[model samples]
Target: MLATVARPSPESDPFSPPGIALEASALMGLRHLARRGTGATTRGRSGLPGGLVTRRRGRGTEPDDVRPWAEGDDVRHIDRNATARTGTLHVRTHHEERDRAVVLLADFRPSMLFGTRRALRSVAAAEALVLLGWRIAGDGGRVGLCVAGAEPLALPPRGAGRGMAALCQGLARGHAGALAAPLHDDPPLSPILEQARALLPAGGHLVLASALDSPGDDFSERLAALAERISVSLILVSDAFERIAPPGLYPYATPDGRRGTARISGRARPAPEDRLAACARLGLACLRLDTETGPEGFAPLMERLDAVL
Candidate 1:
């Protein structure tokens, strides 16, 4: 029987960001292990082919690969087969198989920092990156990360314990560095989108964590274009309270770094649902993580999604 998926609701949702969760250093470690998806779609109902299901190497370690021993290499894990194949001892390097590849596009615009709840959208992005990397790495799948800040950075996918550490560290660093820059500006998505398209291999999945507040509308169009090349998952982070805030006299700041004031006398209009619907029409899996919820709230949703992908 098919399992039912729960519909999203204000009361039922759990994906929220705490005020402070992921520190900068941890993000740097994550960056090293990050890689782009191959843009490959998942298989249909037929399931994986024969011989693909192999035993796992062990906890927190990947399978092995034999290579010729270098001068200063560790001799403890030398393989006998390679010693026989060649006339000398060869080091056995255990490299895990990457069954699935995930690319995280973390967006850290200024708008993401505007939240009314316990945490900002930026916190949600960081948490998602860390949790996703840990879970994916634990499963022996290759994980990669991409940052769409005022500056762009891409971490290639890797399948080793060392690689995972590097990925985490990189993401942590990116998060810290991103905070120092101005968030509002029109960035050309063509180069980054092209890079994303080229990096994602076939059957790979792409996860974009952003607030969708770009002014030029270019990023959204580029995202839609990328979806055609890969299995795209859109994680839109927002604060429910801010999304529905009532209009009143409030202090405000303009995007150009100026203080301003505006009179909002009534309720703000709800964002058009059609924008999200169009994303669905493009075959993108759209998920919203409201900042008002709580940190670690989206872990269950991600766990459930890990299976479906």
Candidate 2:
């Protein structure tokens, strides 16, 4: 059984730093995006008797209704009895067989607290979560989340209701809390992945957003196992500086007033590209979001995400 964190009390601190926040306007924007058809139909191989659940209409066990056939209606779905009786083409439509679980694994470790150009990495992650959550909810699917920080938080999958609202609020609180809380040993991605696997129903979709800079040795094995069971995608959140550090001596100090100076040799970093390649090698779809560019820069990427989910 996975240990679950109790939902935190709503923060009353108006002074909370401008980090990741869940705003109504942003969520509304996502609603508009969904209306514009950003939410992709779900598709994946789950090895189950039935494949992935999708919104697309298809031949299902349960009979829905018979209606006049349209030009694009599948010929196989034509009701022979109705067609003969009415001397007009008629077709059978079925309700969606099932609702798919959409789980978001958001990383809120201390490393996500830093950003140079746009917003903190944590903020970007939160925005991405909100976008995905709303997109799935708008598509009439369930949404859930697993937040990894000092203390991990999990909300089981639910439809667009109070559950989704709680999830949005929880995401904002989790990211904000991470900034003010003391540092601790960050939880490993493997265990979180395990919990997510347990939470998601078969054929469900999982979206993981993180810097993914320090996934432990067991990460690959666990990811591969999870991928075999369900659809898995990765959103690699990174700062421009991480990919190409400026050439100069930089000084930094901790909150405790400990100061240090470091030299940046302008060496090119391959970690970002390497991470993308690794996802490809594992057969996991990956999206890279740079903090400097923000999410708006990835219109094509968002479309790809829609098609995959």
Candidate 3:
């Protein structure tokens, strides 16, 4: 069943930025694409179909039985040996495997509430999760999510149903809450990653979306370990301001209403590319997305994900 939560009106929250508002139209477009099953185009190194293929034994590769050819059956599965021996058209069928689980880890911490281009990092992360959830559900797979903020929310993996809708709603709500009440304490991502790892089954898919600027020192090691068991994708969501702050003093206010001016330099501290390289060194498929683009920005990343999955 899908989870339920109280949704606040858009006008109720004055502090919340407009860009952070969830874009229903964009999400619907992605949902339509997912329902059409148009994103599964990658092949794995083992010669198996990539991006949410069944793992359990089924009518996949290994032949289980030879039966009389039926209309609408795939012609590629024709059993030449059986057909020639019986002097009749026959086709081999294998046991179909169960759907795989897809887990999305969204970092909706206070830091993600800031963005300069299109939407806040938190909103971008939520949008990305929505697209992935729809794609996975449309592909006959299950979707799960873990939203990390001051108060983390976890939804177990489930097939296309109320559970998926609940998960999407939970993300949207969580993003708004995070923006309204930014957390002062830094939330550790390692624990969330560990929890998600424990929840996912072997051969499942995992996607982690966050700035990943200061994931604990052992974050890379833990992520590498998890990738060994399942297909993992890391999305680095950022803002244009975070990438390059103009050379001037900019006034900033905290959640507590404390206002201050900070000086900006020609270069952004802790270059985002450095994190990208770090993820690369760990042999991870990482995609860098900024606020300027919408959820449609995920198309290219999904292509790269096809190769990794």
Candidate 4:
């Protein structure tokens, strides 16, 4: 039997940025949108083929990665970064998800801060993560989080516990930090994938949410390499202005108080299309999510999404 998903009301649009910043409550509320159509997307739709799942060791934590410390845990393997950030004792534990762990990577770079719809692209990314994370956790799977930007934050996979709570807190913190960060060249996604590689086990899933403004020249090569080890899903977060900008100069100011004017025209959009084409070539699962449609529209799209699992 198919399930019908509830629609979020505009008056209480959870994706809306509160006080020009994303509220943690809004992000957590996205979990309700995950109840239906999260698991078993498109029958016979395993992201990475069985033969392509590889075993490799990369820099960063291992699959038996970060988790909340318990009475019997060995304190020496504690993840200082995660522990310090979450203000909770965390220890590295070796474990694997029986049904494949999911690590979500969100791009919080300056580019994602721009939006012309319900909320900033970054906030939408956070919503997408929470929805998917809860769905995965609900299915008795572990979920992890990774933020890509000038400074990246990675949380090891956690089941339905404090670890999951920590992951949400991490997302809120990471987004807030990015919103206040100074303008600079956003880092490439390749390195972040390497970090993800280190986090997952032999067969895991990687979900990336980004605007694709600066994927770096080596993105394809790195993506192809990582695809060999993990099932990869790409969410191209965009805005209406990026696709077809209205003919006018729109004034804008970044979070850091930098003012600028954007000259919107009917020029063809290339970056996103190019990136999508590349992912398509690898037979990767790619989904385009526009900030204009907001979570209200995209959450249902996720139900029918065949490739992202």
Residues 1-309 of candidate 2 have per-residue lDDT tens digits of 011112233664322334344453454454444344442323232211122354445677557789999998889889999999999999998755654777888888766766666677777777776666665675567888888886688888887756567787677667656755654555578988888777888668888988885667789898988888888989888777777776898665433234567688865445877888988688788888887765565434555565666
Compared with the true structure, the alpha-carbon lDDT of candidate 3 equals 0.68
TM-score of each: 0.64, 0.76, 0.76, 0.71
Candidate with the larger TM-score of 2 and 4: 2
- Report the alpha-carbon TM-score of model 4 versus the true structure: 0.71
Candidate 4's residue-wise lDDT over 1-309, tens digit each? 000111235565322335236666666777777766544432224332221222232223345457787897666777898899999998765432234677889888777776666667877777777776776666566788888865689998887746567778888888777765666776787888888778887667888888777778898888887887678888888776677766887676544344567676665457677767778787678878877676677777655442346
Q: How high is the CA lDDT of each candidate model?
A: 0.57, 0.68, 0.68, 0.68
lDDT score for candidate 1 against the true structure: 0.57
Q: Candidate 3 on 168-189: residue-level lDDT in tens? A: 6777667666766634654668
- Backbone clash count, each prediction separately: 50, 2, 6, 1
The segments of candidate 3 whose C-alpha lies over 4 angstroms from its true place after superposition are: 1-12, 15-17, 23-30, 33-50, 54-99, 266-269, 303-307
In what order do the candidates fall by TM-score, top score first?
Answer: 3, 2, 4, 1
Pairing residues by index, what is the TM-score of model 3? 0.76
- Residue 90 lDDT (model 3): 98
Tell me how far the alpha carbon of residue 9 in candidate 4 is from the true structure, in angstroms, after superposition. 30
